[model samples]
Target chain A: MIRGIKLGLLVVCLAMAWGFPAQPAGANSDMPKPAARWVTADHSKFEALKQDFKSGPEVTKACLSCHNEAAGQVMKTIHWTWLSPDAPPEAKLGKGGLVVNNFCIAMPSNEPRCTSCHAGYGWKDKNFDFAKQENVDCLVCHEQTGTYKKFPAGAGNPASEPKKMGPETFLPPEWNKVAQSVARPSRDNCGTCHFYGGGGDMVKHGDLDSSMKNPDRNLDVHMDAKGANFACTRCHTTIAHKISGRAYKTPAAATRISLLKDDQISRITCESCHSETPHKVDVKLNDHTDKVACQTCHIPEFARKLPTKMRWDWATAGQRDAEGKPIKKKGPLGPPSYDGMKGDFTWQKDVRPVYQWFNGSITNVMAYTKIDPSQPVTLAKIDGDPGDANSRIYPFKLHTGRQPYDKSNNTMVVPKLFGPPGSGAYWSDYDWNKAISAGMAYVDLPYSGQYDFVETRYFFQTSHMVAPKDKAVSCQECHTVDSRLKGISGVYMPGRDYNRPLNYLGWGIAAAALLGVGLHGLGRAVARRKNGNHDHQA
Target chain B: MNGNGNGNKPLYLYTRFERFWHWAQAVLIIVLAVTGLEIHGSYTWLGFKRAVEVHNFCAWTWLVLYAFVLFWMATTGEWRQYIPTTKRLIDVALYYMVGIFQGKPHPVPKSERDKHNPLQRMTYLSISLILIPAQMATGFLYYFYNSWALWGWGAKLTLSTVAFIHTAGMFGFLAFLVVHVYMTTTGHTLTCHLKAMCTGWEEVGVPPKS
Candidate 1:
């Protein structure tokens, strides 16, 4: 107790030294306005929600009776279409297009399994109507009750009846209870799909995980349950159901320097709220705000609460036990290292991010882009350099994997991985030839019969899991010989890099000065002792 | 002569203002070097953030002291004490090297008009006119590195180049400090020059006539 008081006193002294007031920020500000009501009317009293809803679409149909144009606005959004509006025709930059990721390869033949995270329902195949109003799954974003979750392989459907799959049960939410629970999206509403992306929890974006749902200030200052308690939509800010905060419509480092000019720029900028000069006391660090993204220093590292998938190797998969049973091996923290259906995996906790200059635009190899078989293929390459004014240093999760590619065609081969028995799925039959042929034909992409696994590198920008300001990366971390930015080039960093010959010369001259002085001082002392001996007849 | 004292009367060697600036610079330079080296990643004493903060504060203080020192030198004509001259330079060098062992006095004796010998004059002058300014200039540039573009030299200068020059200046200071401190012992008595710096008075062979 005494130590705590002493520490508090010391902090107060330091604060005085730095010329900062000891009081908390915003302490003397005007009293905050009373909490505004999120919804104008009680949702339970609405007659539309009182019906016995049979399916997911029936709930959407009822929602449209009052919200009328919500499905149309949602249909035009990236969440519903899964496509980047700014992408070129050949790039096919999202799920709705020909994009392929190394985790699950292409989603062509795996639509039924992958579409569980889709914003709408009944999108099982190419023929799923995009114009249908009832297809929008409103509960996925609006449901306050935690029970409203979709089926894993039911094409975004919730079970109309109480159905048991494995140890979990899926049922249509009760008409009056869960339907009435609809409100603005909570962290759970977003975390249900995005947190579990790429098949399981903490797989793709290491910066996002289940921990953010109920975070303290240490995990996230803004989204802390005990602190600010911000919802995802606070920054994402929707307009007619279309979210405006797409990451790279411009570059990630794009600046809208003035508040008056904010409408001309994209929504994902921190400056939209914080302004050009955010620092009041240590304005020196504010100079770095232009070249260094807030996340690069604030986050320091990601995947803190859970181990994220760092490496995935499909080559070592499909090994069974002596009795022909599926084998599963445990890894660090009991996360799976090898699954007979998946592959060898590596996981990392509290992983320091790879720092890079990004202008917001990421370069990617399209589904049909031929690549060198000898080199590791680039699934998503961070685009930037030191000279670009639009670029700023950002942190990334560089996830690598080894997945199948056509050896002859020089293009990636999307294998059919998730289907029942005798469906020619790689997981079911473990036959590479049958799976590759079926998947390529379904996606309508030409592929050679022969295939081989190719190593792939993908860079996912980490902008979430912002740590408290006090926990920001220290200057010594980058100013030392060993730095997190060792791989980055083009700009000189002091202490990390130096002019070897000049540095050596500097130390040598200093050493020479010391030696010269030492010898001269010794000579004076020795000569004085000898002269005294002669004079005094010692 | 004794080890700590010379068999002579006391004579004034420095003024009150000169003593203050000299001691202040000595202390400031030491503080700056230690904290600056910590920032240079040569060693860790104070943490990096604290080291940077202290270094900047001391640097600003040194600049203020430097301005005062210059004002005093300019107004009082004390700057002439550091005027380089070649007269008796070789003799002063020889006195320290060989003649000092034979009990020869300093080739250039101290007086009201000549505060330094030929060798000391040149050395002190070079440090005041060149080495110190170089450190101050480079340090100024380093501190304002974030405002390089505003100064319109951001395109021409890189951080590595600035740091390289600043590091070289740091070495010069260290070399001068070692020899300068050691030379204090080579006086009429071991404490003669040391005591002169502290009390602004030196025990000379004969007391100055009033």
Candidate 2:
């Protein structure tokens, strides 16, 4: 029994071991690997062939033999500056002198990766030293993999010079002397990087993932077919041997330049081949064109996101009560006072005061102006004792020479009006009630105007605010429209003015009517069948 | 099981105009709901632009039908049936809330004089008199925004408020549709009400008055 149990236990252990297995030994093992090397037509063989052709200058005899003046133009382009000895030290470091790319991982700046796009030799740091400057180096543009001279054309030895002419450069004895020139960078080559996963911070306007999946990825910016027949440099002419925006000066100018202007030609934009006018605005066909920007109203964001609500606030406008006190407390009283004066009262700074008023019930009436101290003041009203024989009138006129109300001073002036006798009524030209009414009306006009503009602009300004006249809108504009005033009760919209009960009642009635008619018809049908059967029996 | 289905005399009073309006309104409502949902991006069976066109067409059709229905109901004295009743209304409410769910029969009986259940009368009355009209008004306000501006009323009225009202109405309609669908399923065999809607004939049976 012990022996049998041991065998069964061993079998179970094997099953569990196989099911929940350990990682393979090869997975974690590490070993030194051979360095990678490129094998192709030997550079020595090509050099030897060139030595026998000591018939003319190297550039003239070897490169211009086919490229002609085209080779000379390429030398002046920004692409060539990648290897220029005079290029800024930071430019050689790639993006902003931070990240280094793997393609040009070594061999200074003149490696295969750098020379692949640059068209020169021995470019390291700021040193662009080239011996054979005019060698068209056909493999760079045509891709290193496929070449006619290296293939069907005499089956050139694979061990020979790896730089073989492409089909475009392959010339017959008669066509050998013909010259071809390419002035611009190819969109396809630019798209290779400008597309979804294109390296670097270029084209950072949202992810281009969906655009890359588009079948026309290989096409030019205009959505036209890019044949393998043309070279990238044909249209992307060299401007001081550098990419476009590297030459920008100001930060603002740099942003505009590097971000690709809407109508300008760039490797990533459709304006490269198509007309700069992206949209044909037939005003008759689309009446909305007068108010809409193509990018502003029709871009991807508009179709996806739209504002659904309007926001407004009115309580922040320094509301006051009938007692000439600021309404600031929660209830129908002004904010609590601590120093024999009202709470911290603040009125709108922009308001121009045209009138003022005071009470005439007390003999020692004092009024203080908060804004100005230098201006001479007049007593508009004063308190008086009733039935006193020596009573005096409350209203008092200011000296003729006193300065008019001066708004420049930031101090308050208190005007004291006192009399030992009784007085009944007091009056002055400064009417606070009338001034407040007028100011309220004026303020409401702009408020209502802004509200109306927001309503109308809602349809078009999906992501914008209705700015208050000249200033941008603030949160308080929409949130605090009806808040507590200083101390008195203020009437907003009163008495069921905006109530929606009628809406509910209307819906209820209509639905009831539909149900009634439907059921009544059914009832009649049943009743008619019963009545007809009874009549037939009779 | 006797010769006739009910004891009342046949009214034969439902005019051809009323029936036409009723059927057309029902069809247009279904079309509108389906097309409106498509516009909301719920489904893409009908492309967005095409769905919008259909929705607009149905909206106009419903508006025209509503006018005719209103005129017919007003002049023919048919609108009287929708007037509210206080007697036995609580019984009708209880029948829907608890009795119906318990498989107990409805308290209200179908007859030539009193066709609608009390709950049906109240709900339909609210929808027809309140919600539908408000939705129509708000919809028109939105559609004629330019005209409103030209008339100078646009300065006072906000389109966002109108949109809020319209969206609120849409929710009301959706709620009504949910109840209607559930009630339809509650009929005998689960499809009895659906068949009646399609053929204008419903099977009648005695309902217990509890």
Candidate 3:
């Protein structure tokens, strides 16, 4: 019997060993060996000859040997005329030629960095030959060859006999046709340059990284997974060579800018793919049509700049001591002072000051001004009151305040005068009636004297008094206005913060119970063991 | 070990109402968890939206049942069973920590009047009265945030803060689930306690001497 048991055990052990492998003791299993290196044929002699051959002349000869007629067509491309002797008069950067980028070290028009994206040869010199069809920089589209690694190795010999170019001289016809079909300029391609992560100057409206990772990020019609897969060119085909005049200025303009228009200037729109109904119920555009765009209200955080430094203290505003005297002295309506000291000053240059003001309980004023006294003053203000009828009008002011002072002594400063209190200088106020009467224009604060044409920038800071903690979206908001389909009736709507404590308590109870049961079971096991030991001794 | 010994009026420990509530809650919670996980795409035990709908329904039922149980306990004076006490608590603790492993007797006896061991009372009291109620409150707060806003609450509260509270509750639930599963395996014969929950009868053991 003992021998049989031993044999059976041996068989089981052998089976286990075969099923699961154990590496040899002390053996290292994970090191990777180096790959073999390759040696290349020597071409040192060709390198010397390369210096003597004029690359431009050689490239021209090569082009003429194959693409005689197509070379003329390629010359008409903007790539051929990239560099010009004279700068365009209409460029925004003024006569020095338009600098498309400012992040790079400022370069003149002749620099290679700028000209690389432009089309032309020997662009650094003013003698750029616009008529040269041979130097039309063909590698932009025909980028298969001339890649950094493949160059020189792939550069055909200058003296080699040229082969006749056929239809193959262009890209594969199928791929070329497909590329044309999907060729509208898309934000994706543009996004390579325009998106926030790409180091471009475009607006970073939504955080792309977080939005992409967010499981619940909203996907509108324009951003539908299927719709986004299509190339941008499938829609935006207008002004193909130059994108300058093709951008949409308004929501209405976007609808009109399609590829199907009689003017052949049409472009695709989001409405093409998405369901037309934006909301659960279609909202009709009445008088508010011009005032709002689908993107204006729905586009998350469109107008939200980072919260300006919070300065207005609502709790302290209009606060008084027991004696009824103002607890804190009020300063002038411009930049806030760090030390609470107010001083009279004059502008030394032309200045345009922007201001933000609240028409509600708290009024905050901020201004930027030129340091010179002789400059004209222009003012802009963003104004609104939460409870007023005309609460959202922002206005611009282009006049100087009339507060006079002794320029020589800089003393006996007359009380600072603002534009007439009801004039179009103040942006917002609590009186809704007055705001409407003023044609929703900004009015100047009241002041009594005349000053120079000094421009001061001001911003009115308003307090968002509504706290987020106390608000919740109720079921009724979705269900009441419509049918029962909107209501989630049987759902266990646990309070927002309740699950954690409940879960914690559940775990605590379970742990305590486990401890109790485990101890009891162990006790029983020990008792059995003791009994067995007693039996064995007997 | 005769039939006569078994006839000793099968000492009733848990009240009928208490047992009913316990079993009901257990069933509801299990259903909630299974369906909840399904809704989250953690598994495909059930279809997606269907699982979500079922989970929500069960959760509501559980909440309602808990409320009724709370009312019954309060009215019938049965809540006294969960009142925590220090008596024999240290002995119970030592039994769990050292004595039980040495084959020593249980410090607290299972009795007709005071059914819970000292540790049991504390655990049940905290879970039933404190944690569950807190979870419910927070969950409700999240569900009705917009309504709260309409009632001038949004003017004060942020949605992000509410979302944080909800997420914290989910973590707590997960922690509880882990401990619950581990404890279920530690009964006499391993499956003894589980069988008792199913049949509503625990095979009483002999009282240990002090």
> Largest lDDT belongs to which candidate?
1
The order of the candidates by TM-score, greatest first, is: 1, 2, 3
Candidate 1 vs candidate 3: which has greater DockQ? 1
**Could you give the candidate ranking by lDDT, starting with the highest?**
1, 3, 2
True contacts kept of each: 0.42, 0.00, 0.06
TM-score per model over all chains: 0.90, 0.35, 0.34
lDDT of 2 by residue, B168-209 (tens): 676577667656765765443357556656555554543332
Off by over 4 Å in 2: A1-97, A100-112, A119-125, A129-538, B1-7, B31-88, B91-121, B129-210
Candidate 2 DockQ, CA atoms: 0.05
| Global lDDT scores for all candidate models | 0.80, 0.36, 0.37
Residue-level error in angstroms, candidate 2, position B100: 9.6
Misplaced by over 4 Å in model 1 are A1-36, A246-253, A258-267, A321-325, A529-538, B1-7, B205-210
Candidate 1 per-residue lDDT over residues B90-192, each given as its tens digit: 9989987887676555777776678899998998888888888888888888888888999899989988888888878877887888888988887766777
Report the number of the highest-DockQ candidate: 1
